[model samples]
Target: MKVSEKWRKVLRRQPRYWIAIIFLSLLILLALFAPLIPIDPNQTDVANMSAGPSLQHIFGTDEIGRDYFIRVVYGGRISLMVGVLAMLASTIIGTLVGLISGYFGGWVDNVLMRFVDILSSIPWLVLVIVLSVLLKPGLVTIIFVIGCFSWMNIARLIRAETLSAKEREYVVYAQFIGEKHSKIIRRHIFPAVLSTLIVAATGSISGAIMTESALSFLGIGIQPPVASWGSLLQNAQSSLQQAPYMAILPGLFIILTVYSFNSLGNFLRDVTLVEG
Candidate 1:
């Protein structure tokens, strides 16, 4: 069957696929229009400080009386941005490394695999925290740190896939037909690996979101004056007793976003397995 037909079948067969699509669509829309939304995240009303949920303030007011709802909306923008950029960066790096290592398969493979193994041995969260401390804390730094640390798993996954793919009959035929090495890898090998790459990308995005949130919660990512889910949680720490919703709203957004990506990744993994 054609690849497009297979993708259609997967979409029809997997409810998780479109469920993620809908969830993510809404989230992306919300994040995109957050500024136009009816509330100002930072606009404070001292008289309403620590207020509970009411019609006026949808998610209630924080310690300084900023609207929790708007803060959560704006926070989604930052969280999703970090997740996507980090995932893209990591996927690009991992794909290149895996392709080179698997295609070359000699001292090159050994060196790359050893490096991956060394990175895999480290506790990733610790590495992210250390890096966040060393670098200036901001959106770019968070994205870079998450992307740098997150590639090892995907690199190993793609390496395994590439090793098998390069040995396939089609690949051998391409080589025999005098196709350039780069061309063969780009055309034949990449297409073969694309499905698994999608799965890896979805997983990486969720992991990146979580990592950014954790870093922000630690007061190192997406610093104040600019809202992010993580920073919201960090700022709420002082008012946890007074305004529980301050943390709850942002935390809920994080959970929903991560869950959406995870479900999508699992669905894609299933689709790849079926196609394989």
Candidate 2:
């Protein structure tokens, strides 16, 4: 069957996936096109401080009277960007390490796998907190720190997949045909492991977002004046009783976005397993 037909069948079988797709699509579109919305997220109104949701401000004005709606939308841009870029960074590093270790085996595998084990043994949150504290807190720093720490699991998964792929008939034939190790890996092993990578990377995006949120909530992720869903929640702490929506709105977005990605990742994993 055609790929589109297969996807439609899956959607029919799992209607909840539709909700996940729609919500994620809307979030990405809003974040990408936020500049066209005409509202300055930081444009505050002293007179309208702490105003509740109204015709003028849909989600309400924040403690400083900035449009909460625009802030949330803009914040999505930052959060999503960090998630995607960090995932890319992790995926690249993981794939490269896994490819090398799996294809070469022997001493290369031992060295790389041992390094991965050492890194994996460290407490993730403690490591992230230490790195965030040591480095200057910003988007790039958060992305780099999360990416560097997040790749070990992906590396293990890809390594296992690559180990299997390298022993397959096609890979053996490629080797027999005098194909370069790099060519064999790129053409044969990488494609075989691509499905696993897709599922892992999908999950990684949500993980990165949640990590960024947690760090920001702790005041070490995204800094002030810059609005992120997490940072917005941080700023809302003082006004939680006075304006519960301040906390609710950003928290709700974080929950929904994370859930949507996770659901979508599960869906993708199922599809990949079926195909395999």
Candidate 3:
């Protein structure tokens, strides 16, 4: 590698990357172990409804006096799960479609690209809303809706990467060696494209979380008794004028979560492109 290239690689592997990894690890651990935390998510304290931050309540209590801290911690699990699963669904389906279309590059490509365009033309949020309406409003529905809409970006990204990768010397050598298309793709192209996909997938999680929050804000996502940042916000919206902290608390978590994920995603994308 050239000097610039070597330096880039070193930068990509620096402590910031490790910090992002550690932050994500701890967030996930917090979500998983939410139940073990001292706060009670569902317990109603009618006497203390709409209380501001206190040592006992930490983030404070909601209208029904449900602990905001506990709800946020619990909400972390479901929202993150939806984002992850939805991204996985989109990545798997979109990667396969993109790879096949890019590799074949003929009538097959035309058909698939046309389908993608058709889907892309529709307002993604509208499409998600329509689909969610058709199905039940819950975790599975949210995942399916977000995944279906989220894949188009990945498909386009993968196609561009494949277009370049197909010209790489190794790919041609693999073909010359009489490797089957599937085998060559699986062994070579997939690994190379996977880094980009992972970076893109991280960004997609933010969108997925926002979508779920939107759905829940409209009362179509994770029903009551089930905690989600969006639903948590929804419950607090009406009382914002009176109990501002109720809305502010969950909103803070939402903002922080989205920013953290986005920062990590950008970091991944920059590092991966350099590695490529």
State which candidate has the highest lDDT. Answer: 2
The runs of at least 3 residues in candidate 3 whose Cα sits more than 4 Å from the true structure, single-residue gaps closed, are 1-25, 273-276
lDDT of each model, Cα atoms only? 0.89, 0.92, 0.83
* Clash-forming residue pairs, model 2: none
Q: Per-residue lDDT of 1-276 in model 1, one digit per residue for the tens? A: 666676678887875678777999999998898878777778999999989999998788888888878888888999999999999999999999998898889999999999999988999899889999999999889999998888988888888999999999989998999999999999988898898999889988999999899999989999989989999999999988878888888898889889999988887776666653
Q: How far off is model 2, as Cα RMSD?
A: 1.2
Which candidate leads in TM-score?
2
Query: How well is each residue in 1-276 modelled by candidate 3, as lDDT tens digits?
Result: 554674457556665655555667887999988878876788999998988889988888888888888888888888899988998998888898899988878998899899999999999888888888889888887888888777988898898888778889999999998999999889888887887888888888888888898888888888878978899889888888878887777677677777778877877666555633
| 10 residues in a row with least lDDT, candidate 3 | 267-276
RMSD of each: 2.0, 1.2, 3.2
lDDT against true structure, model 1: 0.89
By TM-score, is 1 or 3 better?
Answer: 1
Model 1 misplaced regions, further than 4 Å: 1-18, 273-276
Kindly provide the TM-score of model 2 when superposed on the true structure, using C-alpha atoms. 0.97
Q: Rank the candidates by TM-score, best first.
A: 2, 1, 3
